[model samples]
Target: MIKKLKLIDSKFNIENKVGMLTFCRNDIRNALTGSCIINDIINTVEYINKNNTVSVLIITGEGKVFSSGGNIKEMLKKNTSFSGPVEEVEKKYRYGIQQIPLYMEKIEIPTIAAINGPAVGAGFDLACMCDFRIMSNNAFLAESFIDLGIIPGDGGAFFLQRLIGYQKAAELTLTGRKVSASEALELGLILKKVDPNQLLQEAKKFANEIAKKPKNTIRYTKRLLKMGAKLPLKEFLDFCALLQGISHNHKEHKSALKNIKRKM
Candidate 1:
């Protein structure tokens, strides 16, 4: 178990290959700033990745808010005398906002973003990076980066377009729209929406369903999905065909086929 430095005791539950990460930062609506989230996200992801015990991870916020984006108060104070005259602070930590999304995207294990409330800017991008998202009926997504006079530093452009289409993605990014839960569901931005009170429970149910599957198949599928974005159709097909051989020999795959034959 990796010890996370700044969290409130890492109080979460896990069983049968499903882990829950509750955002403990009750302050600032669970803002994932450099100091507050660096160790936490790293530890959470590492714990899930290391333990094959956990096949899926679910993330939710403490109260009504999922995340309020990066600490804008902290960000805007960079050049101010109150922020101190350290150039490294701005250069290093300003860039650190990019890391959380990078880590989220690189996770081999499946992830579920349980959007309990508003997820804006960095928060929205983080949710977008997840394998799937289930939002509360009261929850909303805010692509507020451009509204804040900044371009999204994360892989927002890449994943957003893939989730929705290019035109819709562009509209969201350019207009900095506050997309409601129902609209997000209708547009396929999220898997579904549950009542605010049942958000976490719904997320747990969703994750448990996915966690019951063969892990290797999920990982391979995620890889192909990522690869698909970068490769031509023929090349992607070739790669997938080559990759299928390993799964063809995998024990879970063999067992599934054998069980089907028995049933027949």
Candidate 2:
């Protein structure tokens, strides 16, 4: 049986502030249930958002599969997880697993997904939600919800399209095909592919490079990128001006300018 989700606080090269969330249910390939959604993912992101000391968050699974997504046994039995009439089921989705992405959006820190193995169904969407992704050479991704007679319920439609474009997202979702690690890189879905044993190590190194920069600037830059992606050009420029004002006044910015002058 699966036990629990584990949160780890680690540093890379003694500089980066990193927080890791591991899916500890190795026995079942970290198949997600209602409890894991509420107690593990959503709750953990809440804490990570509050912890200003952490500049980056990395998510991974303990075993060969990143996650199997939903519990098949629960679906078969019409278990409380997905049970009830149509309206009730709709409400369950709105109030349940949907909260994961909603909370994930609120996090100011950058998130990196270290895919150590295959990520299927909603698991694929979960990795897409991250700001960056690195995969194990042995890993792959499958939008396998079509096989279950269901659609992407956990924001995969939105996330996947934004990452890999409409054509590729449609093909993956409709066909339920697996995209290998090399293909993921070629398709611009992941950053790098490494051996399974080095997945976390490389991810930490990547996170450290990002974390070494000004923390507040990194957070604000991420916020700007998200807003810019959806906002009108004029509105995005206005938003950038406002954030730039704040960034210019930050101590880190001031320190960097002073160092530049000294070198000059």
Candidate 3:
């Protein structure tokens, strides 16, 4: 049995094999920096990877704003994670908020970002790190690092381009423009768009759909999808065969087959 997760800046819960993580720092618009949100997110991701009972994760903010990215107050004050010399700041990036993308990449379960409000700078990148994104009609996204005279130091460039292609990603990143839900849907950046009140409900509905599948099969399929993006065709197929062999012998597979025979 898995113990409950303790998070300082977020709320985490699991229901029906679906995990939901909500950013609780609404005061600073759920800023990634200058708060415990980063650790909360990384810890949650790590926990989910070890928790076989969870097959899907849904991330969102508790309040109106999903996340405002880095804390502007901290940036201006040059304190917290944004403090110190140039090299020190680089180290902070390596050891700090950058961990979100790195950890998120390794998660075995499917992740969905329920964008209830604006997700700017690293917040937008955070959403991109998820496998799927569902946005509220009133919400928006922005690659606003450029406007702050900084670049996407948290792997935003890597994930965003993969989501919407390099050209469009470049345009958004360079311009530092806010993308409306409609425009984001048109660009295929978001999988679905709904009213604000329905955002979480929609995300849960989708997450539950994935969670109800054979647990190990869901994880293996997610792994295959992740590998397919980087691995060569031959190597990918080889890995697939290995997993398939194991899957065929699992009790879940036998039960499924029996059910199919009954239906027939």
Q: Which pairs, if any, clash in model 2?
A: none
Candidate 2 displacement at residue 32 in angstroms: 2.3
**Each model's Cα RMSD:** 3.2, 4.3, 1.0
lDDT of 1 at 22: 79
Q: Candidate 2: which stretches are off by over 4 Å?
A: 1-15
Error of 1 at 105 (Å): 2.0
lDDT for residue 19 in candidate 2, whole number 0-100: 74
Predicted candidate 2 versus true structure: per-residue lDDT over 1-264, tens digit per residue: 222334322112223577777787776677766335445776576665665667888888877988878777778775576888999989988887777688778888889899999899888889999999999999899999999999888888989999999999999999999999999999999989999888999999999888888778888988998898889999999999999999888898999899999999
In order of appearance, the predictions have TM-scores of 0.85, 0.91, 0.98
**How well does candidate 1 score on lDDT at residue 73?**
75
lDDT of 1 by residue, 1-264 (tens): 654333552346687778787787766778877335655776677666666667888888888888876777777665531255557545554556666777786777888999999999878988998889999998899888888787776657877888899999999999998999999999999999999888878888878788888887877777788789899999999989977988898998998898899999
lDDT of 3 by residue, 1-264 (tens): 666788999999889999999999999999999899999998898888888989999999988999999999999884678889999999999999989999999899999999999999999999999999999999999999999999999999999999889999999999999899999999999999999999999999999999998999999999999999999999999999999999999998999999999999
- Candidate 2 structure, TM-score to reference: 0.91
Judged by TM-score, which candidate is best?
3
Clashes of each: 0, 0, 0
Root mean square deviation (Cα) for candidate 2: 4.3
Ranking by lDDT: 3, 2, 1
